[model samples]
Target: MRARFIFSALATTLIGTAPALAQDDLSVDQVLGAWQKQKQIFHEAQSSGLGQTRGLKLIAVEGVDAAETAPQQGVSVTASTDAPTSTDTTPMDPNKPLVAATATTTTTTAPLVFGQLDPELQVNLQIKFGFDSAALADDQKPRLDKICQAMKLSDVQLFRIVGHTDTAGTDTYNERLSVLRAKEVARYLVEDCNITASRLETLGLGERFPLNQDDPRADENRRVEFQALS
Candidate 1:
């Protein structure tokens, strides 16, 4: 009973001292104000020439206010000095080709109709087709030999093979016939002269672009020609 009485008295004394200790402690606002005053005094001393070098070392006095240094509302502020890294979770396939994750595509402007050729460099093939047929006649095949020879001799890299037709059939029929004729010439050049098919582009201008503008039905209007692109 005597020991319990002594322990209760010690506890009462500690509880009473706790409020007094808290009352003596500085608050956050008070600590900040004290720091601001120190800063002001340092600046004043410097401006007044009181802080001149007199062959003496300058010492900075630092003090910590327990209230300010203490954790406020159980929150902490810490700084991270390390750089962040990317963590991509995507799985890689060994069989598939590896490429950049982000790709950018660039679009180029297309060339004008008939791949627009220089009129001065135009080669008139004069290869004619049978009436109402896209098939090349036996006599017309020989004319392509000259074209293949010119292509081989010239430094041109690419050519546009354009097919034309006389105004004898409907627009649809003439268009189809002209396309077929252009493809036929391109095929012949590829097979006979060993020209790359990629180097040639076929276009069909049915009665639209003609050498003989005076008469649409003229045999001279029904022809195929080559135009250098590059």
Candidate 2:
């Protein structure tokens, strides 16, 4: 119930609705493209005075000619006659741009940014299980394989395997069933796909989140989903 309420609230709050991601099959390129766009938007929002800004006076390294790069507008840099010696003990790589810090100056530094994909991206897979059993169906293994392939290709390192069930049994029974199904999927991913166990978490939302809310008993309501953690 809580999960359903939260998701519904989020749907209402997010800017204009994003199209739902296709649930038929996993596509690595499509997922990555969406993530990249979201990441850019997240960073731009962070850079707008929301993150910490520190003005830094970049100094030239000794014997290294400093190539001047103009800072963003509204930012100013000042140099001091009493220049501090470079303390960077590490060997310099020729390919890297060189800069020395001398004093405290306020400059806009992008905040530590971590972006989450739009909720519409939560992948809904038709993972089947034997009747009244949590055991995964043999024929449905390929569906899980597709998910593994997508995850390996994606930059996301952690994922949550969320389980749901159709509204058929009691809430308690459905919840337990959902959890067992999710755990089975996670176990398969770890053992069969060589996915790190630590990188996966399982959640049993049970019938709390239904794809076809209008018809709670719809087969589509009984589904497994992938949510990126990081």
Candidate 3:
């Protein structure tokens, strides 16, 4: 009966200690694998992808050891220095003035001439449209002649003749009229002033962009603008 009692006590102790011994004997690789799984769960939870809620539940179960072991799985890890990398991205400056200091350089810097005009010529003409007879009175012919002469003297390259009209007429009628007026002016320049046909371009903007919106029918509304192009 005493021998039977001793055997019973030994059996109880073995049963209680078996699970603890098994846990202690777990291999390092197995421990690392468990850690990796926990890390994967934590990472999956942190990421924006699907199954995030399930991953969060797993992370709660496994804890941060799994996360700590994850980065060591694929490769050997190294400590990183805390210094930021410097980059030289700025362009070199030549230190020269943008606008050179010479009259020839300024004049040859491509004339502000568009089509066949210098914008400065608009000041003397008092008419924005270069060839709109309706905008400029018959008395202004001499002034136009003088302006054309000045353009010729300056060796201008190209002249652009743009025609505009007031909103007094229908869109279709005004468009045609504006185009015809611009063409007529271009013809006069070619025939009367001896300006080359190749040097001129005519455009008609019929009541499109009004200079004065308050009075679309104003005299200034019906005009032509000249642009000189080099």
How would you encode candidate 3's per-residue C-alpha lDDT over 1-230 as one tens digit per residue?
00000001111110111111111233334333333443343344335332223312211111111111111111111112222112221221223111101111111221111111111122112343333222223554454564355445543354445666889878756665565455545555665677776566555556763445677786666665554423
Give the candidate number with the greatest TM-score. Answer: 2
Q: TM-score ranking from best to worst?
A: 2, 1, 3
Q: Residue-wise lDDT of candidate 1 within 1-230, one digit each (tens)?
A: 00000001111110111110110133334323332433343334345443432211122211211121111111111112232112321332323222111112232232221222222223455665555455555677776665666566654455556677888888767765676567667766776687766566555667665556567787767777654434
C-alpha displacement of 91 in model 2, angstroms? 56
Off by over 4 Å in 2: 1-22, 34-119
- What are the lDDT scores of the predictions, listed in order? 0.44, 0.50, 0.37
Candidate numbers, best lDDT first, in rank order: 2, 1, 3
TM-score for every candidate vs. truth?
Answer: 0.48, 0.56, 0.41
Regions of model 1 farther than 4 Å from truth: 1-112, 115-121
User: Model 1 compared with the native: what TM-score?
Assistant: 0.48
**Model 3, runs deviating above 4 Å:** 1-140
Clashing residue pairs in all predictions, respectively, total 0, 5, 16
**Candidate 1 vs 2: which has more TM-score:** 2
Cα deviation of 134 in candidate 2 (Å)? 1.3
Model 1 CA lDDT for position 55 = 19
lDDT of 2: 0.50
